[model samples]
Target chain A: MKFRMNPVYKKELKISVRTVRMAMIILGYNAVLALIGLLSFYFTFNYSFNNNIDYSGILQIYLILAVIEFGLVLFVVPAFTASAISGEREKQTLEILLTTKLKPSQIIFGKLLSSISSTLLLVFSSLPILAIVFSIGGIRLFDLIQLMLFCVTTAIFVGSIGIFFSTCFKKTVPSTVFTYGSIILLVIGTLAIIAVSYMIGVRNYDNLYSASSTMIEYNPPGVGHAINLLLINPAVSLLALLSKQFGSPSYLSSLLSHYGKTNTVIFDHWYAISILIQMLLAVVLLCISVRTLDPLKNKK
Target chain B: MLEIQGLYKHYGKFTALNGLNLELKKGELFGFVGPNGAGKTTTMKIVSGLLNADAGDVFVDGINIRKDKKKLKEKIGYMPDFFGVYDNLKVVEYMEFYASIYGIEGKPAKKLIYELLELVNLSECAGNYVDGLSRGMKQRLCLARCLIHDPELLILDEPASGLDPRARFEMKEILRNLNHKGKTIIISSHILPELSQMCSTIGIIQKGTMVLKGTVEEIMQQMNVSNPLLIQVVEGQDKVISLLKRNPFVENIAIKGSNYSIGFKGNKVEEANLLHSLIENDIRISSFFRQEGTLESLFIQITKEEEGEKIEV
Candidate 1:
């Protein structure tokens, strides 16, 4: 696809990429990725390579690397965007920028694009380390492509959350805090609520009938309820995607397997559905941020 | 040219602007002088399209600011009272960034950036980081940034605030040059003397309303102090006072430290006649001349009149 450049995006990229701090961040990010990959390799070789060079261990290494990349995306993307708008306000530059001819959507899109681009640089920099699985026999190139796409989508989604809060709050500290808080709510809090709902549904079903009755329970209410919850839960969907990749439930999704099988239609399609949900979230958040920024527009 | 009519704004019940009406003609250097919290910044923001007005219409070259906000952005260059710069950007790069925002690119943008740097007297420091510049230099750089797009109208809110005397003088000179170039400038400041020197017209606002607006001479005439004649006499002070009071051209006698100052309404001939009368009376006159009404005095008189009008109401 052809790229239509935004001036704000171009300028922000120039400023960020030219900084010594960005150089150091890229160096540090690669160093951490290299160190983790080496350690995982050492452990996998010491245990499995002594007798049999098992391909299963290589797949385990790929999963470890993917999880590490995902964790890094969660921690790094917000740092770029949480202070995107609030920092401009703090530096006393937002007013001058607002007076320019650019629309509010261009401003927000530029911030998000710059942030996502920075994180993508880090993600792509570690591709060689993730490429170690190619020497082994388990992971395919298509799997790696899917993994990278997932990382990019995750960064866009998380970065939008940061930009949204940055516009809502006046100070950078609160905006950053609330951005991380939102990630936690999406990842952990959603699962906790779904679990509680599943238990409550099962308890209500049992209460509706006597325990000794020989009645066959068809597709229990709790299992269907949990499946719906997992369908929308980003963390769960991510785990489900990984489970489908390795032909077994990953650690997180394993805990929720009693509610539903990974091969079910919705579970099998979790990756596409999760990406759709994240894209929708990014658009909604960016709209709110743009509306909050332009004073000439209606407040409500 | 710009016109604002029936402008009203309130922040949580505290009125910032109340039915404010103001107009500026093309090629006019209008000084917007007011006390703190008198809505100077608010009015400028509204004109610049940076803030929304509750009930108002700001027209620039016959285009409504609300309807064509983007068109207003192209016509007006706004320099806020307080601002900042990106530390990572060089002076030249900063200008280029803004030029690109206006859709000027490549060679044209580079030429404009160099021209702007020269205009602001920062040609030697084009490669220097923006955050490394001194406050005066930064102010000039911001002014250069505002002119990158060659906007017709410049709205500067307290451009000289927090500057040293030398820096303030330099800023005043720059503004004078810009005004001489036929740019319509609306500058707000508390420095009355500076405004008097640089601005052709002055508007004084109080409590979110304009108290008076006109040329210096017109405002002086409105204040009834068009020609205040001051005379000093060492001897026959009572005779001098009596003589001035009896003359048809002299009125409002005020005395201080062996000097008599009175309001005189007449042409050069009448002024010379009054002086001759003082001399013929043998009042031992020490000095005599008409007092040029100052901006400070006009401000004080307008505020006092407003106070009186409020009390009467």
Candidate 2:
């Protein structure tokens, strides 16, 4: 009951507000994305009111945007958070803090949460733009909800990874470089694997003559299946949201069918399982970070 | 109260502390003086639970450091040589951060932080960002941070190493104040004069071994036992020296400047008799003081023996 709300979280939150660059980055990014979305809306409405000439296509556009946003978060969160612990070490302050009554778990969790919150602020800042996109209709609340949830979960997981690396390296630069490096490897490596798997799977020798006419559709290499593949990597937890929301039969063509998943409860979303997995992995990594940072072991 | 028994620490094959033993009573301020590579910081680190000893037990207020280490940490406060700070954070917020670590918050936390800042004389700088503060301010704030938990023992490793003259005086005053409040403090430094002024007892460790430890006066007595001492007087220097030469307690005497350089003998009662004889000789003694041994002098004397002899560790 006496758990300390991480001072790291509070300090980070304060710093996030005070720093000019944080505001510029978060606000400026959302504004640019919003400007693009609004300009597209103007062009579409000006051309035709074909009843469906609304934000129906907006989800796909923003889904791509979501991936970009989450990708940026994945790369940036670690750079910011990975140095949290090691920064303390470099400043030579970690020793004094360790002497406090604070538990190691509390300190690590606090640092992780602080980093996640800063990254989450960027995700949350895009809410008004998202709301504008929804003004044209066809965008369900569940879509936005899933988007928010995935963004938070992915940031938490990535932030945990960052903090874990921070604990491993005593200096800030190496921890930061290593954290960003790992994220790049995770994101790109998974994408490369999925692409390769889809390429090989689609290359059936029996359909060689048909392969010339074979068009990858309904389940494009870059769409639903690719989205599903991203669920395993915490860096792309946000992609699972698009898969859950936009991969529906209503959103996609009825050409591809999968049981028990094409139609999911609107409220009791199945993607929660993937979200939980990502959250669990983050928590576990954070626990390991806490353990590694325990100063008594270092002294020995 | 603090006790470290058989503390042994090694970095690879290089031993830092070899069978080091130390004790301090409640409300006692002990100065730990040693040359570089003398294991003073290593000993302080282990005792503070910032480091673990290879083979030893550290107890603070009768509580073992290893058993429920966090609880022991609550009883001990440590201020390393260089303290750190957070970005864009006020002095009050910095204190609150550590206060929260100790599970103190809200009104209780604010009250404590306010009091600590006031104690460190940084109360006016409560709203100022830590980065904007001066080095001396940071040092004082660090001291305040350590005392946030109202800890029983403070383990300071070279707290005054980089401080300027005024800042060092401020730090000494703070330590003296804390010691006056009956707090037990173990401070490690290489400065002999500051330790003599501040600490009631002193421990001199050389190359992982504590060469000497006791009350400041007691240590000086032990270190300079039977060593030559000069008793300076204003006038009648020859009469005092000749009179003192006749006494068996006086080994011999040499007149230096206007004072008598008396080679002191072993017995305290004999010294008292010699002093009485000087008074009877109408020697208007300007100053009659024994040459007090210093930590610096002893450290140089002891460590120099093994210096440059190709020490394996």
Candidate 3:
């Protein structure tokens, strides 16, 4: 079959990208990235740095810049995607769209693609500055590629979540708030659960050692499961990637390695696993979003 | 041709369509007249494939909508009552967008878009932003968008709902032209006189069911109400009144100046016999003609009957 782009995606992109608002957003985004890069350079120069050009310092700047860019993407992607369907409904264009021959899945995917593509533009624009880390010898080209992939995957994941909420709610404000609320719950809730479980493990070990009254060492049961839980947390995955890149043991990796030799497949390769989890979440949310959009499928 | 059989739809606890059945033949201008919340829009949505009936089937050109919506959608063009336009798209681009939605693109899509815009009398505003167009112009643009695919059946839901008199007239002219071109149209409107003037057939729905249907003459006959015949006499008004009263077919004779307005319930032969009796009585009649039953009266009569039935139930 001959392939065709979703008409909605084409039209939305044509209208959105041609707007003054999108131009201002791009200008504002690049300015912020440049400011962050300059600030990182100034801080690196003034703080403890070698007399020669320090590659590790540059790597730190790269990581900080990447995090800031990711933060901006997370903030902006939901605002766009969360309003995709609800905005159509509010503007009264959804009924016309529904009467067309386009399938629900095509509509959902088109909305998602347009939302993430804008964020990807921002991510790709910051790549030249990110390439400065390549010359520093610590961060390789493959690391930058992996980081860009992670950024894109994260955008798709978050964009799909916003679309899912957009399909569920009637108004854009509520859908947007719910999308952000879900991200917050995923990030903080996962970390909070891990912290509570760790405390419980430490307390239980203390109790067990006291009852035995012998110098017996204790390792928490199901530490691998706990590490698997952290795999879904993007912050933890970023931390693990940064530590691996700099060849320095950060707190995230130290925590994982502190536990005994359990199968830490996810923890050892946390970056890849985090991306896979994000992809899985994106697929699930997109499926649900398409289903919600299809009235017939919704009933049956 | 389109056929909707035993269509039923429910929104939560309320029933929107209950065993509703309707059919439209080729080249027909089918006017769907109904009051608010009478399931006109619900049925339109189902036929457009934007909604699914709870228990029924919609067939366009003998292809079941449920079995092959993708193929069926190509044969139907739907214009909603309140559709929105894109913010920055030009009128021509707006047409092109919907044309592309129906799988027509590139140069052929461009040519088709221009033809549709010309059909809707929007050729002058083709280059202007869609958002900049007036409400009537925007409505016309939406109509143009609907015809971009050249579908055989056009389903227009309240196409002239918020239009001014001039705009309504223009829209009517456009629809009349489209109907003249042999396209089947299903139009829902509360403006019964407009429908009476244009539609070849009409179906009035009330309480989620078809209360009255068929051609205007057929519905007038089905209503079973007496036709009001007005007779004017140059000099024998009293004689005419006496003669009309004596006639068995005439009732409720009322006087307006030198004219007599009486309720005549009989067919053409009986009306001719009554007229012959009036002439033989030496009543010099200046004029005598029967008023045709209007769609407005028929709609009111049918809905009143529906209300009576509901109260009895």
Considering every candidate listed, which one attains the maximal TM-score?
A: 3
Q: What is the interface RMSD of each candidate, in Å?
A: 1.8, 1.6, 1.8
* Candidate 1, residue B293: lDDT: 70
A66-129 in candidate 1: lDDT tens per residue? 8888888888899889999998899888889889888888888888899888888888888888
**What lDDT score goes with residue A168 in model 2?**
92
Ranking by DockQ: 1, 3, 2
lDDT of model number 2: 0.75
Q: Candidate 3's residue-wise lDDT over A171-210, tens digit each?
A: 9999999999988876777777766777777788778877
TM-score, chain B only, every model? 0.89, 0.84, 0.91
Question: Mind giving the per-residue lDDT tens digits that candidate 1 earns over B1-313?
Answer: 9999989999888988988888899888999988888899999998988889999789998899999988999999999887578877899888888888898888998898888888778999999999899888889899999998898999999998888888899889988889889899999998898998889888988777877788866665555446578888877777876787788977588889798778787766888898888778877877877777778887776666644132110
Candidate 1 regions with alpha-carbon error over 4 angstroms:
A1-4, A202-223, A249-257, A260-265, B220-228, B234-238, B247-258, B263-273, B279-284, B304-313
- Pairs with backbone N, CA or C atoms under 3 Å apart (clashes), candidate 3: none
Interface RMSD computed for candidate 2 is what? 1.6
Identify the leading candidate in terms of lDDT.
1
Can you write out model 3's per-residue Cα lDDT over B194-240, one digit (the tens) per residue? 99888889998887787667876676665544668878888766677
